[model samples]
Target: MITPSVSDPSPRRRSEKSRSATLSAALELCAENGYGKVTIEAIAARAGVSKKTIYRWWSTKGAILLDAVTELVASGSPLPDTGDIEADLRTHIGSLVRLFTSPVIGPAYTGILAELLHDERLARAVNDELVIPRVALVYQRMRGAQEQGQLPPDADLPLAVEMMYGPLYYRHALGRSYPDEQRIETLVAHVMRALRTPAPS
Candidate 1:
């Protein structure tokens, strides 16, 4: 067993602190100035860290913004397993609606996603950082429902997920509207009806 010096700042701990500071700064700048106006230098200045530090961690402001959004989403309630998939899904969808319609994070997310349209790499990173984890949660919940005989074994989890969230994303992309509670209820019901397994003869 190798004993480390007590005064030594562990590299991993320092790295984590740096990362958290950078994300916080990035999110703040994006929210305050809109994503289009935020620069790496601004983020570094806000974070009181070096621009090189930001560059060493992320290749673009888009990547940092995605990380911040992912952090925000992950901090929210996880998908519920309340034995009622519809209710659980409604709650999840409602949370997403609120998140994307909020005054702070909403504009930030919208700006970053708009930028993502022209940058394939940034889009991929956003998908990896933001979309995939949320999809995995929904997929996992759907699989559990399948095990409970709520869905067919061959239930198209991915398609069902898209059906549930695609419209929300579309609305945000267009900056035209947002789903109210009734709309969320309708979407959840539609997806559930589409996803449920038929009764056996």
Candidate 2:
């Protein structure tokens, strides 16, 4: 009988470290030089890893940027989940606005979103990893409220999610304004009022 050797899990940790290093390097480059100027060789040199290692992990610069964005969001922000739906939604959107408007993240986010518009793979990654989870959390909270009779049973969840996020993103992207507490409070009031109003039969 042939004996099989068991592999150590420490390699997994090392791999994760290498991946993180590469992602951090990519984000720094993107922040300093924009997406067009970032190259695999620059990322490898910044990360202190070989080009082959980066190639082994990701196929394109866009993939590296996507991973970097994912890491940034995951590490820097915690999505709000306070018990009150309106307050939680407002807090969540406000946090996002802060993140989107930050000096380090603002430009990177805009660049990645532009790439996502043209690349289906990048679009799916952004939607699945970033957008869906946050939206789904809010949706779950709204559903719970409906079950408790706090919100109307016939409430439109997708529309509600859009309502919570759309205006904030629009103002952030186009208007170049950071949403302050007053703006968040006003949005919360409007949304709550809309929820309370009975839909026409």
Candidate 3:
């Protein structure tokens, strides 16, 4: 009896399988060997695909990592809104700090920043594709807090948002600070203090 050829499977199904495997390989290699060390050949070899196949989907290693990070974030980690801006900010910001310092994704993301400094296209993709949408959700939360009297009516929500996340990114991503539970709480409290409305006289 003759068996059906592997190519008998739908091309779309095979394409998706290859895509998922490639992304998983990229993430694994990035975690094991820093992003700077990850190469298209390495990802292809790990994923059991060919270099041409990787290049067919992604141009650079950074591009592949960007796609991986995008998929990770899109799954289930949006900023939470519980009708308490302070709680939401603390949870969101702390989660970001942890994510940026985690063994798996942190290394992968660190190298992306270096490329973003020089690669204008990747920079835009990182900002427009990854950063803006998440930040926009935080902005919406800030607006809600302001409307509900948690923050000042005329507070600089955009600037405040920057201030809130900037230090965490700078310390963890750029500098090298790892926030513990106490430290995260302190930082959250600081942000809350800055944004909280004053009590009536």
All-Cα superposition RMSD per candidate = 3.0, 3.5, 4.0
Question: Which residue pairs clash within candidate 2?
Answer: none
- The top-ranked prediction according to lDDT is 1
Ranked by TM-score, the better of candidates 1 and 3 is: 1
Which residue pairs show backbone clashes in model 1? none
lDDT, candidates in the order shown: 0.85, 0.78, 0.81
Better of 2 and 3 by lDDT: 3
Write model 2 residue lDDT over 1-201, tens digit each, in one string. Answer: 454345444667777878989988888888899877889999999999899999998888888877776666665655554666777766666777777777667767777777777899888888888878778877887888788777888878778778888886677556467768898889877877788787899
Clashing residue pairs in candidate 3 (N, C-alpha, C atoms within 3 angstroms): none
- Tens-place lDDT per residue, model 3, 19-49, is 9999889989999988778989999999999
How many collisions between residues are there in candidate 2?
A: 0
lDDT of 1 by residue, 139-159 (tens): 899889989987888778889
How many clashes in each structure? 0, 0, 0
Model with the higher lDDT, candidate 1 or 2:
1
The predicted structure with the larger TM-score, 1 or 2, is: 1
When sorted by lDDT, best at the front, the candidate numbers are 1, 3, 2
What candidate 1 gets wrong by more than 4 Å, as runs, is 1-9, 197-201
